[model samples]
Target: MSPFNNTTFTHAVFLLTGIPGKEDVYLWITIPFCLVYVISILGNSLILFVIKTDSSLHEPMFIFLSMLAVADLGLSIATIPTILGVFLFNSREIGVNGCFAQLFFIHFSQFTESSVLLFMAFDRLVAISNPLRYTSILTLPRIAIMGLVCVLRGFALILPLPLLLKRYRYCQDNVLSHSYCLHQEVMKLACADITVNNIYGLAISILTMGLDSLLIFISYVMILKTVLSIASREECLKALKTCGSHLCIVLLFYSPEISLSVTHRFMHSSSHLLQIILGYIYMLVPPLMNPIVYSVQSTHLRVRLIRLFVK
Candidate 1:
C-alpha cells in the first residue's frame, strides 16, 4: 500500500542454498566448480593461443571462435567467484551495489556471448554460402569491428538495467534466492512499481536474444537449403560436420535459458534449487563443453591445441 514500504533496509542477506550433502557439502560443489573453472580457463586460453600463434587459423571462423572463448572465460570469471565465496566462506551477504555490479557483469557477458554466437553463425553462412569471398568479407579489421560491435551491443542493451535498479526501493526481501543477484530477483525486491522494469527487460531480451536466435535460425535454414542443393553427399556431410559443434553449442545455450525464464516466471519457488543448478550449468557447462566440442570436432584447432600443449 505504501510507496516506500520496503525502503527501510539499506542491505539484505542473500541466500545461497542447494548443497545436496551435509555440512561439508560445500567441498563437493567447490571442488567440481573449481575443476570446471580451471578447465574452462585452460581450454579457452588454449583456443586463444592457437588462434594467435597459428597463421593457418587466422581465418574468420577461428577468429570468431577465439572471441567466443574469451567471452565464455569472462562469463565464467564473473559468476564463479561469488559462487565459490558462498560455498567457501558460507556467507551470502552482498551489498546492494555489489549485487548490482555482479548482475551487470553477468548479463553483460551473457549478451556478449550470445552476440558472438550470432556472429559465428554469420561466419559459417559466409564460409559455406560464399566461400570465395569469405576471407575478404571477414578480414581481420572487419572481424575486429564485429567483435567491437558485439561488445558495444551488449553494453548498450544492458545499460539501462542498473539505472532501472537505481529507481527501485528494495524493501521486500534484500536476500536474493540465488548466489548472485539476477535481474528478475532484484526487480522483485523493489518497493516501487516494477511494470516499467519488466517491460524494459522483456524488450531487451526480445531485441537482443530473441532477434539473435531468429537470425541464427534463418541463417541455418538458408545453410540447410544450400547444403541440400549440393550434388555430392560427402560435401554435404563435410559441411554439416563443420557446423555440428556450433549447432550443439547453440542448442545447449538457448534451451536451458528459455526454460529457466519460463520456469522462473510461472513455477517460481517450486524449483528454486533446480533454477540455481541450471544457472550454474548454463554458465559453466558451455565453457567446459566448448573446448571439448572444438577439440573433438575441429581438426585444425585440435591439432593446434595439442601442439601448443606439447611445446
Candidate 2:
C-alpha cells in the first residue's frame, strides 16, 4: 500500500451518483440531460449577447435581465460537468476539495439567482411605482454595485460551509446523493457532529431563499396594487405585460426549488427516484426555461434575436 492509503480527517474521495441503482442506464439518460444543458447555455448566451450589442437594451430592466442570464449560465456551467461526467462516462469519483468547491459554487449561483430575482422585483416595482424616479434610482453604477453585493452575500453565507465540513469525519460510505454536491445532502453523510452544520444550513436557507421569496411576493403584491390603480384597462394590460416574462421566470425558478426543499424536509417516504428527479428539475429547468419565456414574451427581445440571426 502507498503512504496515502489511509483515509484521514483532511481529505477523501466521494462517489457522486446519478439516480441511485440506475447507473447502468445513465448513458441512455444522458441524452435529454445533454439537450437541456445545451439549450440553457445557448439561450442564456444569446440573451447576454443581445443585451450587449443593443444600445436600447442598456437600461436598468435589460441590465438586470442580463444579470439573470449570467447567473443562470453560471448555475448550468457549475453543475453540468459533473452531471455529464456521471451520465456519459460513468465518472463519479470526485475529490473532497472538489466536492466542497462545487458545493460553494452551486449554492453561490443559486443564491445569486435568488438575489437577481429580488433585484428584478425591485426593478419592476420601481419602474411601475415611481416611473419618474426609476432612472434616477437605478443607475448603471448602482446596478453594478447591487450585483456585486449579491455575489458577496452568497459567498459570505456559503463560504463557511465547506470549512465546517472539513472539520468533520467522513470515514464511511462517501457516496453523494446527486451528481453534484449540496449542503444538506453532503452533510447527512458526515459521521461526525453535525448539529452546528444543520443549524447554520437551516438559518442560511431561511435567510437567503426564504427571505428572497417573501420579498419577491411582497414586491408583486405592491406591483399588482400599483397596476390595478391605473385608470384604463388597456393601459393596465400594457403595463402588466412588461412583467409577464419576469413573473414566469420567477415561478419557473422558485416552484421547483420549493418542491425540492419540501421533499428533503417532509417527504421522508418519497422514492429516491422522485427525489432525484425533483433535484434535476430544480437544477435544470430554470436556465432552460428563462430565455425561452423571455424570447416568447418580450417582443423587443424577439425582434432583436431575429435581427441577429438575419445579420
The deviation in Å at residue 268 for candidate 1 is 3.1
Q: Residue 162's C-alpha lDDT in candidate 2?
A: 95
Ten-residue region with minimum lDDT total, candidate 2: 1-10
lDDT of each: 0.82, 0.89
Q: In terms of lDDT, which candidate is strongest?
A: 2
Which segments of candidate 1 are over 4 A away from where they belong? 1-24
In model 1, the Cα lDDT at residue 192 comes to 81
**TM-score of each model, in listed order:** 0.93, 0.95
In candidate 1, which residue pairs get closer than 3 Å at backbone N, Cα or C atoms, i.e. clash? Answer: 6-171, 13-175
Taking the tens digit of each residue's C-alpha lDDT, what string does model 2 give over 1-311? Answer: 32113677445778888888787787789899999999999999999999999999899888888988998998999998799999888898888888899998889899999999999999999999999999999999999999999989999999999999888777657777799999888888777779999899989989999999999999999999999999999989988998988899889888989888888877888887888888999999999999999899988889999999999
RMSD of each: 2.7, 2.1
Model 2 alpha-carbon drift over 4 Å, by segment: 1-6, 9-11
